[model samples]
Target: MPAGVLFMFIIVFTTLVAVRMNSYVISALIIYVFFSIIGAVDDIAKVINQRKIAKGLISKQDYQYKADGISAGLRLFLYMTISLLVAMAAYKYIPNINGDINLPFISIVKRFPSLPFWLFIPFMTFTIAIFANGVNFTDGFDTLATVPSICCFVFVGIISFISSNSIWSNYLLIPHIVGLQEILPLIGAVIGTLLAYLWFNSPPSTIIMGDSGSVGLGGLIGILFIFTKAGFYLPLVGFIFFMEFASVAIQIGYFKLTGKRVFLMAPIHHHFQIMMRKSGLYKGEFQIKSKIAWRFHILSVVCLVLGLALFLKIR
Candidate 1:
């Protein structure tokens, strides 16, 4: 599981930080482990169940629970194991973080109390659940999931532009964080991985990012952004996610209050899919101009661009 690999990274990193006497990384490591195990168990159980179902002891409906989930679990398990071994090697690549690497940004971090770092754990956890659940709930058509995610990641990756450069951090008056450059590679890895995922997730998607990748990616963005001092604008950067989730939240709240449906269903994407399927919009002269998946990708990119502009402008 990618969660496991990420946990491995956090653990090794925290141990080194602990060995070096910085406790924040240790705190983060604890949170990372907790999150990773939760996801890993879910993944492991799904994979085991899928195998049983494939053996014909269980019904095919079991396999249909999350078609891509089992494969994702297997990928996550292998990747985590490999990452632990590789993370061990990175220690040799980067012996230790020094004053030079930690400079310019270190002072800015000192401005904040240590409590925020600890509190950041809950923030990250909730954000992941919301982000992942929103993505999963929104997955009704092609490009809807992956493309929006790509925009979100790219918007998040731009944080490095502010965090990586001391001059920019100073000019922007944002908290400077040394060693945040480490997140750049993480973002690159995600983008590259998504590119591979997109090959199958485009048009008629053969695979979905499922909850694993969605939650994983969302958590990665939130944590890296805050660690890099760009946490302030995450909501705006992920505006579409918030809007999509809000629709469902509003629907549920309304139904509880009035016992009436809102938007015809939860997560407006599915409502659009229903309309398209019923109207034969896929094959008719009145075929929808902006299909559900296409609109998701476009709107996500548009908002990401706007968010980036806001970031560059305000910062």
Candidate 2:
């Protein structure tokens, strides 16, 4: 249902934006395709995959189902981390990559001459991945990942709007943007739909977003900023993603490197989920499962606010 609402919102946002922008038929069609189809395809695929498992068609369910409830947070985390590293490296050693959409959108601007892009990649990858995972990490339970994603996108998309127009860009002290404004409304609508989806997806989630949703969200975020081309700033925005992945990363690292397990389970959320019963965190706790999820909403909101302030100040 949460996924369905996102689909519907994408449709509405696409149609209105297309008409308002007077986009060419092809462009408008593409917009519809991206928002309506590309955005939702991952979720659909997950459903298909899960159905296969349910029907005993596929048996590889070990790690596949591990991140089910926490996928949205995880995907955005990793995609941004990897993407940021690539972008920074490209911006550094390679020749200038500036243009309309061709430019490395998110990484170090060639003109900035600040940090060497190459030098930034490792730090960027780890940091961005950590932060991105943080959002997921905070996603302890229902409505956590989806609700915050919706809010963050709305805020991030608005930044694009400020950049889209020269006047507003100047007023906001942001760069002038083109064609990106279209993405803002599209994202807004997508997230708006996601917001609606959260109504049904919150505590005791009826439908887990799974990795399909998380990774896709991260990918879309990369595309939106032209960051995918260069892989920049992922660490800054995707704080929550990195943290979640880090838990697993750390767990794996320790086990492999030191031969010890950190948490009884990885991702941290599952640890809490498991311990909740033993620790009495969920016993008659008005849906103990739900109480866990509410924690995510609060944490993501905190990360969102902090990330927004930093991004704007840095840019």
Candidate 3:
């Protein structure tokens, strides 16, 4: 069973019970479930392909596309289209969710650089699509994506709490977005779901949160950043996910341009794994993986703290 199935249920149930079904939470849940459905389609396709291969009904080489889940091209198309629609909806329906954004280290008074709709819509769509893939890429390792995701939600929750209150927003010099607090329960539910996921996804994981969970979580996080007007802080709050995504992009781009590989493998974590294996310092796969997981977890924590301090206290 795809772990995302459980994640969906838990998040939905927890959020609904913990908070009133306000417009903010309702919109968030709808957007989250929409992206999750896209991911679930890919997951289901991969499972069907695996079963076919196991039964010798289809050759693995011939069905390689299916084995890898939905084709990358199709998945990208879906991501772009669905996220664009979501962005449009947010702009049209959500209050105070305009092109204005919050920047780190800048007073919110000066940071409200209002962008034109054309640019803002595409930017929002790009953010949602990119982070969805970023989390998906980071999910390559056990428990790697979970910590960072939890950290991100924690940041979003704090920012939302601050943004919803006039006094705190004024004190912090952040935007006072009405109804923003309504999404706190959703953020809390997501954090709780990830923590529950971590219990099983710790090193030597029994169940992996495949693309279904990763993509959904990533997409939701991206939207949360926008909704909270903290989109600029994504690079800091989601530092690990950004690095993972950047490594792959750099490796591929560099290889195509110069016919040279940047790392032993794409995704910095895998490069580290290959390096450790080559160094003969680690005794086995478990040790190398454990080291990587712990290091990334610590990095996520540091980024979370720095991001919060810079956004809230550094004024």
Evaluate all candidate structures by whole-model CA lDDT and list the values in order.
0.54, 0.51, 0.86
Residues 54-167, model 3: lDDT tens digits: 999999796775655768888889889988988888788876867998776667676567778998999899888889889988987789899999999999999999889999
**Tens digits of per-residue lDDT for model 2 on 35-149?**
2333355456666677777888876664376324336555445445455645455445333223222122232233433334445454344433343335434444566566556
Candidate 2 TM-score over all chains jointly:
0.62
How close is each model in CA RMSD to the real structure? 9.0, 7.4, 1.7
- Order of quality (lDDT): 3, 1, 2
Model 2 residue 72 distance off true place after TM-score fit, in angstroms: 16
Model 1, span 86-198: residue lDDT tens:
22332223322111122223344445423232354444445545654465555445556667777876875676656667898777655455655555544555566667767
Candidate 1 global Cα RMSD: 9.0
lDDT of 2 at 94: 34
Sliding window of 10 residues with minimal summed lDDT for model 2: 96-105
For this target, which candidate reaches the highest TM-score against the unseen true structure?
3
